[model samples]
Target: MPRMLDVSDEVRAEIGDEEAARLLAGESAPGSYDCTSCRTPGDSAQERTSTVLFIGDETAVLAFAHATCLPSQVVQVTEEQLQGAVRAIGGTGAESPQQQYQSPQHPQQQYEAVQQTPQEPQPQAANLVPEQAVLGVTSGLVLLQGELHPALVVEPTAPVARPGSLGSGDDFLPLLIEQGFMPLTELAGVPPVLHGWSVLLAAGQLHAVLQPSPNGGRPVAWWQAHQPLQVTDGWRAAANKHQQVLMFAAPVGSIGRQPREDLLRDALDKAAANGKLVASALPLAGI
Candidate 1:
């Protein structure tokens, strides 16, 4: 029996036409599988299913999702993220520094905060940030129009200068705007989805923020964590609920280290009012 699968040209290119044909002929495709986007059971024989290929540095994993939740495409990730996902899927008791940790009592608060300090600088030649500065990421649930949404706030520790430019001036928000991030005066509604950009959450933890590559093959890491940061279960739930993450950016010192969600919102609003914030809704990886 033929399956109701939508194998995209991009996905087919990665998996090859022959393998894609096998999937279309129902020779290798699963009859029933959980949607990678929503984690809900989907029957490919009855519903329009999408083939999502997650390509990593060393390996690749082909996953499935419902057409409505996510389209058929390829999502690039790091080798560590792929390994972590394998562990999560296998229920291995292995523990590492990047292991996912959750505390029931402090469900909303991150277990480890020190690991979030800025260190990793990706694509050094591109000059993402100043040589002395680092990006600081904070996770929280943002309230927009009386509803909660998963959010990641990005701020640099120092001013971000333009690539190959002399003199020190912050081009943080402007650079993001060029990359499709929208400026906001108020949090009226969800920001528009920025294509070619996505959040990396592997093993149920915050991993990295991916951006369109300079040379254009796979999306490169715009902001990568020194170690995977554990987010609140509530934050993860909201991300899965909406299938997107609200990403906001501000210049250095615009939105400082906010200790609480309420504080984070207050800082965000202040940044927006001061014209220091830009945002966009990025779909979770696997789309």
Candidate 2:
């Protein structure tokens, strides 16, 4: 039987005509899948489906989404991120240092993990402060130039400090720029895919989302939780299958806490409108 499918040029290029033809023929496609964008159920045989391809540094994965949620496109990712996604999909444990200490068996262990600081006080860099600031992040999908793009809206709860200049007003955007985050003057196209940063989704939940470091060392978690944030199963499935995630950041007061996804989206729009948004798209690697 023929199925309703739409394969984008980017996806077709990645998967080649032969594989794409098989998918369109339903010979190498799943009958039903979770929509990559909205995490809703979609049936390729019954309704229009889009072929979304996730291309990592080392491999590529084909995924399906509803035409309404996300159009067919090729998402670029990194090899490490792809491996982590595979592990998550296969139910293999790839625990982070904090995760290892956050075992449910020991409440004390979890407490310690939360309080744990880096061994030896690391010296402050340019655009860095000695004191750590907790950043609040809200993530949602946004339509840009007629394309659905995953975006994260970030804001620090308090004014960020600069080294030896405590309370000198929020230097958050400058700090981010110093760390390689680019401010968005326009949203003409997706920002250049930033490297060494990713949003971690595992076990049908939103885990730690990361930010790039100044030293070009390991990326640091920008948002982590005492307990992982619960999310729709379809969201986690899409994260694992796509193996790529996009992140956006802004300064203090650029965006605020919203109780619902709709409100969060509005906040993102406001930030973008104010010209206070910085964005990056990275592959899903280990936390």
lDDT of 2 by residue, 1-287 (tens): 56698988766665567656777897767676645444456788999987765444445455566665556765444445444433433233433221112222222321111111112111211122245666665556656677555555667766777777846677777877776677776555667666666665432335466676555654555555434444444444444444565567777777776787677767766787888887766665422
Tell me the tens digit of each residue's lDDT in model 1 across 99-207: 1222232233222101011122122111245556788888899999989999999888888888788968888889889989999998789999998898876445566
For every candidate structure, what is the RMSD over all alpha carbons to the true structure, in angstroms?
Answer: 11.0, 13.1
Candidate 2 wrongly placed segments (more than 4 Å): 1-132, 211-219, 237-242, 259-262
RMSD of 1: 11.0
TM-scores of all candidate predictions against the true structure? 0.68, 0.50
Worst 10 residues of 1 by lDDT: 112-121
Q: Which lDDT value does model 2 have at 228?
A: 40
Error of 1 at 171 (Å): 1.9
In order, candidate lDDTs are: 0.71, 0.56
